[model samples]
Target: MQNNFIFFFYLLAFLLYIPTLILGTFLKPPTKKQISPPTPQSILARIKKGSKYTKQALEDFEKLFLNAQSCDQTLWLEIIKEFALSPSLEIKEITSLQEKLKQNNPNLQNEIALTISVAIKERK
Candidate 1:
């Protein structure tokens, strides 16, 4: 009876070890998939250009900004409306704009600047 018990224990151990050995043999690291660092081309690919919305917005933005800078209320409001419908300008310009607006509100200065930026981006 002791011999039978020892045989049972050995058999279980062998069974567990066999699966581990087989899995280790079959499960190998993938050879085809190679991860490479980002190149200039990849970075360039991320950049987007040429859009009607952006073009129009940039034009209006530039116009408004210049108009406001020069204190031209007549042109500023008209340009602001044109850009309001499409405001997909650069983030840096937008941040600067928000800061400008906060610093000086209801003064048409910041509004004109943002409007002109949008217009410029759209053009190119």
Candidate 2:
């Protein structure tokens, strides 16, 4: 009975020490720095970068149409949709591109036409 009581007393002491062993009682929690939200200028810069990337993608598509480059149909489709949705490209520019695509690939011409129609519908 005495041994059992001693065993329990040591067990209780060991259990109490576990918390201090894992996290020292004297240690302070680390401080976190505040994060600032994006400013208007930063937003504008990002938009400009996106516009530049869109223009470059359109140029790549033009190269493919001109037979100076080639890409898979799925990539072509993505570029077509991106070009159509871009506010940077004018309707007349897309129309001219549609004509060029007609001579190269009917499918791309149709996709461009669909995009143009959507743009027009959105405007109305």
> Considering every candidate listed, which one attains the maximal lDDT?
2
lDDT per residue for candidate 2 within 1-124, as digits (tens), equals 9999999999999999998877886687888989765433333343346666555555655654333135455544445555555677777876776677667765456665776578556744
lDDT of each: 0.51, 0.60
Flag regions of model 1 displaced more than 4 Å: 28-37, 49-88, 91-124
Best by TM-score: 2
Q: Which lDDT value does model 1 have at 57?
A: 43
The all-Cα superposition gives candidate 2 an RMSD in Å to the true structure of 12.8
- Backbone clashes under 3 angstroms, per model: 16, 0
- What TM-score, to 2 decimals, does candidate 2 have? 0.45
